[model samples]
Target: MPVALEIVSPEKLLLSRNVEMVVIPASEGEMGVLPNHAPMIVLLRGGTIAIHEGGKVTDRLYVSGGFAEITPERCTVLADEAVPTSELSRAEGERRLSAAEAEYNATDKNDVPSLDAAMDRMQSARAMIEAAAA
Candidate 1:
């Protein structure tokens, strides 16, 4: 049985379909979700979400960061930012990386939240560049 997968960003729903399997970049590491999986919620890292069907990966999406809710029959992703892997631009990623690095450097070390946000941006930008290359 296929599991229903919904990938949603703040702006719109990126994809909604039944996939044979879906791999997510969870904060703990990568995780594969299939039909009848246990219920849980996980924090997503900046990476790719691979949708598998017909024994192969059919779609790939890059997410900045997000939360994923998984149930026995479905998986839903609430993404901060998401786009098709093919749509990621290396040049844009590079530009964002540079900006994030500057922000990180300027942020006060004692301000944990600000530092973390900057770090997340840097990581997300790097992931976008890598995804574009693949």
Candidate 2:
């Protein structure tokens, strides 16, 4: 039995397919899910989600943060933000990185919330760039 995998963000449904396997960037670590896997829910971190079919990686997506629900026959990811690697451009990534850096630099050091948000954006932008390159 193939596992049905779905990835969604606030704006849209990123992916929906019956994949042979999937590797998610779980908060605990990378978790590989195959058909008939046990049920669970996991927090996601900033990283790639690899979709495999016939022992080969058929697709990859970058997700900033999310939660995933895993069951015996399906996996669903509700992401804070997500983008397919193929859709990301190097130039756009660079632009985002630069903008985030500039914002981070301008923010007051004493403002913890702003600093954290800026840092997260910087990291997400960097990861997207890397994923696009790969």
lDDT of 1 by residue, 1-134 (tens): 89999999999998999999999999889999999999999999899999999999999999999999999999999999999998899999999999999999999999999999999899989999999999
C-alpha lDDT (0 to 100) for residue 74 of candidate 2: 98
For model 1, the stretches where C-alpha displacement exceeds 4 angstroms are none
Query: Per-residue lDDT tens digits of candidate 2, residues 9-126?
Result: 9999989999999999897888999999999999887778999999999999989878999999999999998988888787877898999999999999999999988997887778
Model 2 per-residue lDDT at 111: 100
Candidate 1 clash pair list: none
lDDT of 1 at 6: 98
In model 2, the clashing pairs are none
Q: What is the C-alpha RMSD of each candidate to the true structure, in Å?
A: 0.8, 2.1
Whole-model Cα lDDT of every candidate shown, in order:
0.96, 0.91
Top-lDDT candidate index: 1
Please list the residue runs of candidate 2 whose C-alpha ends up more than 4 Å from where it truly belongs after superposition.
none
Looking at model 2, residue 52 earns an lDDT score of: 98
Task: Give all TM-scores, in the order shown.
Answer: 0.97, 0.82
